[model samples]
Target chain A: MIQRRPDWLAGYGLLSPAIIIMAVMMVTPLLAMVALSFWTQQGFELDRSFTLANYFALVEPSSEPTYWMGIPFPLTYPVPAILLIKSLAMSLAITLAVIALAYPMAYFLAFHVRGQKALWLVLLTIPFWTSYLLRVFAWKIMLGFNGAINSGLKSLGILTEPLSFLLYNPLAVMITLIHAWVAFAVLPIFVSLDKIDRSYLEAATDLGDSRLRRFLQVTLPLSAPGTIGAALLVFIPTVGDYVTPTLVGGPSGTMIGNLIQELFLKQNNAPLGAAVSITMMVTIAAIVTLFLWLIGFRRLRSRAR
Target chain B: MQRIKFIDRMASGRIDRRTMLRQAGAFGVGLLVLPRLPQAAEVLTCLEWAGYDSPDYFKSYTAKHGGAPNFSIFSGEEDALAKVLAGFKADVMHPCNYSVNRFVNAKVAAEIDTTKLSNWKDVFPALQMASGVVMDGKVVMAPADWGNSSIAYRTDLVDPEYAKNESWSIFYDDKYAGKVCMLDNEIAITIGMMVGGEKYETAAVATGEKLAAAAKEWGTKVVKNSRFLWNDPSELQQALASGEVVAAYAWNDVYRNLKRENIPVAYAKPKEGYFTWFCGLTMLNTGKADPALAYDFIDAWLSPDTGKQLIEGSGYGHANMKSFEISDKQAITDMGITDPAEHMKQGTLLIQVSDAVQTEWNKAWGDLKALKQ
Candidate 1:
């Protein structure tokens, strides 16, 4: 007659390592950031007073909200809020575009390729072998006014003038991001697509389903997990990316990350930067949670079977 | 051949316990000596910019002390300040005149006892007591090198007459649209303020609203006509050399670099005056190194030979004016100013602006850089 082991204790034992890691690495810093969000900075000194001044000013309208680019009350919102909204929009666009572009690629690798699968996978990761900054600067060299594209065009007599529009734009930013993040997108999606049983496709085909119909009925539903995984991988990091924008986005391409960096590193205002960071993290978390709730992970798992 | 085979087999994981013990013993011996190999000599650490760290500049000190100093560099003064304030110490630090005040006020730097510096009398008078060099009636910074921020232009592309009438307004000229690059710094706003005809004294402590308004107009205007905002000096240098941009808000160093390469570049004497800056050595208060050694390092930096290399190699003005005699005539002539002190009188020296003013400038720059209009 041994004492029965409690289910809760066993579960806690199993999770203790991860729980400790989360508490030390993630939760502690998160708590510190939350506390800092309530503090204020005067000049070079950080005042530890619990106040809402930073949050209030974050949403405060300018004394005179003049229109620029025909947008109404463009300066109505403060710096952090405006940049956060812009970065979110940019990230969403990149996520959707990347996923859409990545799906067919993953499909091809999963189904169409017959030999040297490992070689193809290695080739796909070649861009990542170099430094991320170097890769981004490589894009800068290609897109710059006097860079590869414009120089090539000029030399070929296709264009008399170097194109200024190719670089330092949001379009350039997205292009670089797609290149930077494609491997992240491809691997997860490819793994999901690859993991699908071939018999499912055969079974769907045997029931008089067309190729596209078979893909929709069986293939698409099974690959949802990888697509979701790929989206999170690409979207979460791109929202806070500033170096890409700093190097290639030119004047019109600054993101919230740059503002947060300036606030913390340059302006001696860690509290405000912390507030911005917390706000951004919460916003992203809320949006992702809402998305998961709408899609229903349980539904995805059941459908995969 | 049998021994080689045995070694290869050992490497391939076929080693016996005895062989493994031998390999481990070899590694242990290697590790014991590795830390003392290259740096057995006493290191005199100097924190400075990219070009200043070379052993060539510290030859006098090295010749005297029997070893070269260790080098660490910071891209900007703010970064250097942050590092020093966070207790990163060095024997000597190079900060511009405008930023040395922050180091003084923060007590991150110690006062320089000028009597110890051998070349103290040879340094130019203007730089010796320049803003932020002196604190509590003692010199805290020994002036080393100086330069000006002005338009560096392709003489082959832009007309000499137009460039001669230079103002910061050249950055706003639509004639150079999609062909101009400006520095991406808070100092770029100073150029804007200069072109806008704002008084420097007033602009340094302007209210946030006033700063916002002024920067919105002037900063936005500069960005509107520019092709890109360059964070690194080399970017503008490449752009100018490649004929991508005809003109850029560049330093005298860029002018020197292009001229050395025969790239037909010139530093403009803008009507609004150049934004002059001075660089010098500041002794770290928290430095664990010998004070006398630090003073020797500063003296070496200000010595005429080091100053010669500064003028000829780096293309920046040295505080020891006698270095001008040692510098090549062509190099001095190509720089367009033999006397830095005289040139400084014709320009404006950048001073430390208040924290509030800096914050507003940073905000305005962020907003303006992102705004399409």
Candidate 2:
């Protein structure tokens, strides 16, 4: 006689390896980070205590007064809060710009270009084949004061003076991020666009609908998942990006990730770094959740199901 | 390169097609039959910076032992400390004076038996008892390389008069507004302390209140005026070379590199004082290392021959005075160290501040960077 096994048992068995891996690799570190967020760091020691001081320090004011233009200004803005807000704003800008640039290219690849689509896609990803650090360095070279663009423009008599505005600013950081991570945006949008049934457009045409109307009615709604995916892919990573900013993001362009890196690396304050990391992660997760909600989470779930 | 090698092999005609095929089959069989073996332990493991691992610096040890010590290199001391504390067992670890205290306090580094070290007497007297090297009258570190953090200006771009009267405040001067760069580290904040009139002792161990006050003064002046903050050597070089930045808070090596190319750059002896730092070796308390071998490694690193090689090859000042004997006065002057002892005394050494102070300094820096206006 054979004993009947529960179906869920088989499912659990199939998922055990992945579950174990995720638990070990992702969840453990996340839990440790959470624990560390509550701890405090002294000169060379980590004091494990259940205190909210690390988080509080994020909002602690500099009691000293700063005078800008002879008007007394209080140090009301906490560093962490300002950095968080700055990172969010910058990431949003980069995400929007990347989507704006990539959507058209992806659409062109998926819908318009008929020959050697694979080749075009491969060529699009050629820049990505090199290291991200290398690409960022290349951008630095290209955007420098006496860099390729400046020298080229100077040689062509486009301008007499080399432009200093091209590099080491928020604009440069945004430009580099778009170039570096735009491919991440492209592939997702391309997948969604490519998956759209051509018959839907044909049906709209048959119904005497205009192309714009057809896109608004069907194409836009159908590609929402991919667009959201693209936004998430670009927004989340760029928000925590310190390297690009450190490389090109002059005085004004420092991001939250730089602060965290300093705390963990240079300052040797792991607890503070942990707190910052947890806060940044939670903030990103919340933003992602809101984004999903705005784009109809239920619909996305149903589509996946 | 692999293609060239294949072509060469074919051209050589050492093996015909049949032989090559047979050999290929044999190789494929060999690959499957090959057994994995445990690696032999190499004594005198040192975790250090890039240039320290050069064969020239460790010739005596390699020549005697028939192998170079195992090496694991770190770009920064913070990383080295973290790795060592996290159970990375190296016989010796390289750390600067600023970070040696952390290693000692954490017990990742054991007190060095200086009596066992032959070249211990040769290390600079100032560095022998430098802030982090000596704790409780015990020398925990064998001091090695030293360099100064000073202002490096393009002689052609910056005025000779202004460069002559070098002040830390030059970094914040509105006259050089987009033409100035600063190092992206806490060292800048330390420079800021000096710029804000904080004393050396106060600056070295500044706590929350002191840090805030200092930051309020210095942050407003310098942080905003900086065109960029560079950490990488190449980036700093590019900025100066292209006339993008006329002046930068940089290491002595930057001065050396520029002058080598005849780029008309000068290292400033800032009136506030040059920010000097020294790096050295410490024996890790890993309990795995053979103590005798570790002592030998330290001695070899501090030996006159090694010191000579370090200065000649890496263009850094070694702790041993005998090392300077190998070089001419011109080379010494060019290195911005005409008198080592005098220079060390004149320069303010970077020391480990309380973690609380570090946090405050970091916060101030963050606010400075976040300052839009």
Candidate 3:
């Protein structure tokens, strides 16, 4: 006797177009970028000599002079090194701030809100429909000394003078990044939360687990993947972002990305810029790997139980 | 069951062979045609600083020419150079006088034909001959606009008495340290070199040791007190309006815009005189040559009408002699160039620093920034 065959191959044949597009558009550029990071330029010409100078420069700080008193101090610390440290600090701060603010909102949308999950999700994504540049500029205007927020506060007699600290500060950069990336942090967590089966919570309750215990065990562990994914999404882009820091970060808020721009655009130093880019990529990759490892470890432990 | 199996086998065998051949043929045709497709439009892109090619000005040029000239705006000369070196094919670029020599030495710009520019004679001869333009008897660039690197202060926020002094000392004064802003530009920082009694070429070629010492001392005095080191005029304007910064190093147009907006900001010609940057248009030898169109564009931009428009719109003093006559003298004076020739003499062109010296400047700037932390 013989049997009939499945028709899923036809569907896969249709998907080949999309698969080819991904390979060419996404994978090809990534491969090209990796190649470019290793390449160096000399004067008006690009040199094909494979060198680690670019990578070294990224990891090593600039050898520029450090001034002290009337004496000139030749400081070993390079700009790239400083930028790496600064970018990491700033990106981490932003990630933590987003997590702190977004987790609760995601929680509310997942558990507290009923029959309006889609509505709130759409609302969360509304800000993204506007131009990113315009959104950042809006923050600039709102935080301006005579801007709406300051003027509003003054009108309410809550402050004596318009706050000077509102704009051109690290605080402003943080605020803008948080607002810009809130949806990025929230959606993933929400999706994870929504996927949790209600019967599991009921089972936990039947097992005499308290609300906090149930959340810690079932909900938090289950949501770990989403939370980690959200962090990686936000942290990687924020660390290398130049516009946000330039527009709102002021002098104090300038980041490694700004220096990389200076190298690539201002200084006309391709090798140095590539070095900076590669350095950032490596650092971010290491951090992301560590995070994924932790997540995997937790998953394994959960599976073992 | 036998009939059903035989039918399934027939369908699978027929479809699989047909699909495989079709996919192979499609891939082969795509591979052949993709490389043959024509590239995007050829543009004589200009990498310029802001205010050089604002929409209002470019729109008129585009309207007359039937198309807009492509402009890739950059905030800093270093950034512009980096882009240029990284395979950006801009036919024309606007690097300041100081960096022109470097561009020329690096063979970035082609030797320009001065005779092609009809309004060449109308440019202020001194500015036209600024250090970056005529290198080794080759006219590299046509000077567009020249101005002093002076301070702009908010009269409404800063005491009139303090600002009335009209000296560079006010910027370094402890009284205004936390309320002062400086331009985050090499040219603006070079003013500190002048104030420290170093000449343009000397500062340009200053060793890492000298630069580090000067920058450290300058940094210690100013960085902490600096309310902001701004890249854009708009940022400076915001700082002035908010009282976060009472004074700042700025170009003339920034102050003009503030006054126009009723912000009461005033520009002063410091007693130490002001450092100047003269930007010029230079042609690049992109593999595809368009010398005629490039020359036509250059001449059109230098025409008295265009020059006058730039003066009126950008508030930067034009180098074109014909523009001085065509532009409103009172308006020109209001923009702070009372005597264009005298102002040109007072202002000095920025010179390009060699790699060795630039390393020093970078180090010093980094240390200065680090001091804040």
Candidate 4:
């Protein structure tokens, strides 16, 4: 009675469809983006001139200082360098803020609450069920000088006049983005927390470890992967976002995404816009790769023990 | 054992070979055929501003014509131009005078044959030759609608005495710092340059340095005080109705809507002179359909009766002079045009700037944004 082994060729056949689809959909677009970064537009049509001018413009400093002694200083211009810096700062700020608010809420659902986990998840997702633009608009109304918040405060005699710091500023943009992306940060952390085995906590406690210590040594390390994934998920999209900034950010709150939009839409400079996009993509990829490598190296060292 | 193994191996090989071949064939066929599908439509499509193609205004024309004109509205000239360059198929476009040169330079629009338009003589001469309208020694746009950018404020919130005066300085006052509003567009920002006594040059020819200097100086002031920089008329309306803003740079149509809703709003006559924009319709090279339909649509829009309907519906002034006779003079007066000729003379037409100048302007805007409180 001899048995036949399973065929490896059949398994490859099953995966070929997905492999082909990915090459056409994802790989081709990425190649095109890289190619477009090098091409410049002549009038309306794109010309295939391979030039480093776009990349040079991105990293170059202003030709003149913004101000001088006594006399009005020559105007200082913002190149791609400044825009990229500003975008990174805004994205990081939003990511940190969201994580700070979401982690505790996710923890409450996973550990503190017994059953009602499904109920709370639905509540967390309620804000997102509405239109994205509408939700932002609602936030704008609530924060406006004559909005409910200011009106309520005025009625309570908390202050004399409507608060001027309500909307159309960096604070407004930050707050709105946090509200918009809270669900994104919460779900991942929740899943990570849920996956932690109860036996690990029991083992730590049996050894006379404190509750905080148990969490710090065991739970935090286990959830690092989810935390990193959530951070990237929020950071990458927020960096390229223009809608929120445009609606809520005043002149002082303009971001790199706004500049990219202006270049492609208003200035008709696609090559320069493409250059900015490529630079951002590469920067994000490098940072993410470095982070993963560090995590992998640590895992290997721990396993050796 | 050998017989069973041979049968299993044969089945696996057949399956793998068949699947791989099918995928390759599908991919090759899709790649070859996808790029050639005609994205261009057989009929002319007009890309216009939002209110230009309201159902009330164009329903009659659509019914009379064999087929209704295809139209899509854009928020701004830059948005329209961006869509066109992205290979959006449109046979005609409605951009303001300031943007015509860029359209022509980009070869997105075709030169107009003045003879094709029966109402060509009715167009305002200033609009026909405005710095933004010239392209290769030809008139590329037939003027469609005209309006002035003026200050709109809440009569109840702003003091009546201060509202009567015409001054750009009003927007900079501390009293209105948190209550005031302005457009987040280059044209509105350039008004600050005009008030500062900067020499006027067509944006198409202005040097990058000049634009940057103007942007930096004006941007600092505008950003420091502006409570909100609105992107659309609706946003301005929200600001006004909610009392978040007592005063703002606005169009006549905005004032008209507020008035109809019984909200207290009025247009101020700024002393420095109002900044104005003139928009017109022009044919694009992409139109493969009857150019006649495009011509008919323009003709209908310019006719006295149709022009009256458009003005009344959209609250924008008609380019056709005859339409004024049919429209109520009192209504026009309420729109802040007591004397059309005088207003036109005192007004400055917004001009399109070259790419280099625009870059300088953006830098200046950035510097202003970077200013510390």
Best by lDDT: 1
The sequence of per-residue lDDT tens digits that candidate 1 reaches over residues B45-158 is 778876667776767999899887777776566656666654676778898877777777666788888988889998888777766677677788888888888888888888
Candidate 3: stretches off by over 4 Å = A1-48, A54-75, A298-305, B1-21, B27-43, B55-64, B126-130, B199-201, B220-223, B287-289, B312-315, B332-341, B359-372
Could you give the CAPRI-style class of model 3? acceptable
lDDT of 3 by residue, B115-231 (tens): 988879888777776667788888898877766667888787777786657766666678886688887654444566667777766765666667666665665566666777776
TM-score of every candidate: 0.86, 0.83, 0.85, 0.84
| Fnat of each prediction, in sequence | 0.35, 0.37, 0.23, 0.35
Q: Kindly list the per-residue Cα lDDT of model 4 for residues A50-165, writing each as its tens digit.
A: 98877876655555643421333333334455556667878889999988888888888888889888998999899888999998888877887778799899899997788878
**How many collisions per candidate?**
1, 0, 14, 4
- Model 1's CAPRI class? incorrect
| Candidate 2 chain A weakest ten by summed lDDT | A1-10
Ranking by DockQ: 4, 3, 1, 2
lDDT of 3 by residue, A145-215 (tens): 77889999989999887787777767898899989998889999989988999899999999999999999
State each model's C-alpha RMSD to the native. 7.0, 9.5, 5.2, 5.4
Q: Model 2, which residues run further than 4 Å from truth?
A: A1-7, A59-77, A297-305, B1-37, B42-56, B61-91, B124-132, B196-199, B275-277, B286-296, B310-315, B333-339, B346-373
Q: Between 2 and 4, whose lDDT is larger? A: 2
What is the C-alpha lDDT profile of model 2 across B1-373, one tens digit per residue?
A: 9556644544444334454466567868999988968766546778877556778876777777788788987756666776665567788888888877767777788888889988888777877777777878888888888878888898888877976688878876789888888876655666777776777667766666666676667665676667777656667887788788889988766777777888989888888887777888888887465788788778888888887766665467888878888766666665766445666677877777654554566556656665544
The iRMS of model 4 comes to 6.8
lDDT of 2: 0.78
